[model samples]
Target: MTTPLPQKSFHDVRQALLARQEIALVDVREEDPFAQAHPLFAANFSAGRIEIEAWNRIPRRDTAIVVLDNGEGLAEPAARTLQNLGYTDVALLAGGLQGWIDAGGEIFKDVNVPSKAFGELVESQRHTPSLSAEEVKALIDQKADVVVLDARRFDEYQTMSIPTGISVPGAELVLRAQALAPNPQTRIIVNCAGRTRSIIGTQSLVNAGIPNPVSALRNGTIGWKLAGQVLDHGAERQGRALTEKTSADAARQARAVADRAGVQRAQPADLAAFQAEAGRTTYRFDVRTAEEFSAGHLPGFLNTPGGQLVQETDVSAPVRGARIVLADTDGDGGVRANMTASWLAQMGWDVWVLDGSPAADWSETGQPAAAVPPPEGHTEWISPAQLSTWLQGDTAAETVVLDMTTSVNYVKRHIPGAWYISRTDLADALAKVPKAQRYVLTCGSSLLARYAVADVARLTGAEVFVLKGGTAAWITEKLPLEHGETHLASPRTDRYRRPYEGTDSPREAMQGYLDWEFGLVDQLGRDGTHGFRVI
Candidate 1:
């Protein structure tokens, strides 16, 4: 038998790390757990991503690596996997992460890595004056000079954010901060689900060289809920402040920003004219958070969060030459939209921002008014009655029914014979979906189902249909609903759990898997390999 690799003690690893030795401390934990607590130097490497993403994460083979897991028996195998990948100096931590902590060694909290740390810093400094739910309600009553920045992801902000807080994700802080307050003296605050992001985000600006004092919304909205503060929903946040700048003023500012960035400003009439123009690929993007986008955005506008749009323009708008129009709410929304427009212009795209703020009422603007059409080439519209008929008809042997709802709903109940596809996994699933068969898309609501139908149709050119009113409607009608398998990926076989979904597998396993997958993709790109596509 081959000789077993030697293990290193916590003291040995600590000494090595403190000496500034070239080392990569990999915490084999799930992101959520890892986020809560981790070694200051530890980077996450889930087993699920090992094959695909790990290599790219740990590029230097010479750097000594110490892998850790929570009392779970993953540390040894994970180290071995690294060794197999040609990492010459890999070892397992003595007793995994807990062992390190138990050894009376110092553990670091809030060790936000580069990009995410940078995002947190932005939230800390620029996205400031966030109010707790109760505080915000009080502010509304008091009419204070404070502006609440919903530092959570846009979708979350849209779904249920403090009514006063405008959606501005953590990453967009640097670019949009200046426009958000305009007046440097205006108190700015940042908030998230809990204290971590809000606290760290507020601190980031303090760390940055920005000339502003910032603070976090204490405990975020959760604290507000605990305090029994009520949250406003739907059209409550849409009402415009009568005393604030008029829509015309906001439009003029938007036009000026667009002009400065060398982007065209599309007035309502111009948009109508552009829509009428033939053969031009025009993509309307509501560059807001998902929640806001979902909470009644322009018909036909795709929800591409501003920060994501800036970072992943190629994926968001694959058509390089297409005209892109972005919309956001007033203040923070305009800031993000204008910032993205600036970047698109720099990249040689014909970009534009909608002339005015995204108010509740856009009906007065003579812009092209039309419902968001189903994805191009999607000819089939299945009614509730037609679904049974369609299900009965033999379409293909491998027809996949993908439910893109929240994991909780998927776990509670889903369409019979449907494979659950969480939103996070949509892109990956879309890529792997067989081209030969039709795809059926459903969600908690009809809107998401319709969107997925359009998306899959666009990406795969697959014959797709949306389940009208979605699973909620189906459940209400007392239609059949199948309970999804408790474990989608076998823990024994796959070695990792799906991160976003609930799974029996350890968090370290999932992180390792993702790290491996990312590494593989990087290697493939470096080797000039192609044809195998990621959704």
Candidate 2:
């Protein structure tokens, strides 16, 4: 028999937030559903993969955890899973999501609401300088002395960008802006897919005391599209490598900003002390480019480029109030770490930059710690060769392949006949599939599929098998793939399509996205639970 779990009232949760207490308000639903409606600080730990993601996200076994769902019946089971994983203070939100709503809590739509709301708050407090899309487009038409820089990732720049805009991702704005705009008179405009990165990036240059006039492109590409301005597709301009003097200058400015923001500096001994803190969660990240991190990084640090770290703080440090130690060894001291930590500090995080050299602990490559092994269970696995034979066999009609991948990846490519479905919706969607005697689960890699096998077997009462190595392995062996939206077993709400993410977003969606962002400040005002304090 199970013990009756404790319950947290919405008012109790609000008090915890007010006190800045260490608490994890977990939403145990699919990312899509979680994005549709959730409290301001809720961290999504999707129901299906709770076992894989819980340990790293909530490191302390005794941390206060309140799991919730919108009548989806996932919270109780998720709470039990947390208990099984040695979590001591796990409980369910009384009345789940609905209770929070009844208690006058505001519901926010979208993943990373905390980070996004903070961005709006930053703009409100700092009034970060920006240029209207029409003004930027006019400057481009006149071939004025301006350099437009895309602060998002390089791939994002490649999709759709302002005419002649060059890719100079996040922290690189400080490191490479001088080289890009040699003339001090050149006007600099920084942009991202949307508001967060643009605000943070443009403010970074201004905060760094760059001689060039700096401003973010208002509303980013979305604003440009709404202004009836044409965007350049397949733009290839990239920021050149930073020189030694540039690196040193950037380091000096970054350190000054970080110091102003009261970011702490931690040496190896300090880091050891942080790791020993009882009931405290600490995340170690290397804020450098993926290439640099891949070439060499500290033993235990995960790589999240400095720019993305600032733009997606909620994703990077989901355990709100966790201590974050950023490490960088770009041969220019801790410039990258300092710059990234400065924003995180301003965003109300307990962030620090690792000091001195990390040379001794450097590794040529690093992989994340392995996930806890799946519990003992009845699971079956099928090799790619066997799957191929089955696909060609007389019983092929009785077997169904469900590819549980992001909607974007599903549209890009998948097995020729596989149906796309959210792992969380497996039970409901199974009924929609053509009746089958056998089911094979697959994803980009087989990690998620492995987790889904047992539940699928019990739900459908069919022989369930995981496709070994998943779809990637099949493609490696010259198998055929079908692209486009052909076989969708469920609605494509598993992933939210950002207006600025891809090339061909509908214009109305772009306008809706901007409208949604414009209202965030008002929403944050109503929520009042976001303890965002901008420095």
How does candidate 2 score on lDDT? 0.83
The global C-alpha lDDT for each of the candidates, from Candidate 1 onward, is 0.56, 0.83
lDDT of 2 by residue, 22-70 (tens): 7889998877788888998888887767777787677778889999999
Instruction: Give lDDT: candidate 2, residue 251.
Output: 84
Residue 144 error, candidate 1, Å: 3.0
Task: Give the range where candidate 1 is weakest over 10 consecutive residues by summed lDDT.
Answer: 526-535
* CA lDDT, candidate 2, residue 374: 72
For candidate 2, list the clashing residue pairs, or say none. none
lDDT of 2 at 111: 70
lDDT of 1: 0.56
lDDT of 1 by residue, 218-309 (tens): 65655555556655443123212322343334444444545665877777677777777754556778776565666667765667776566
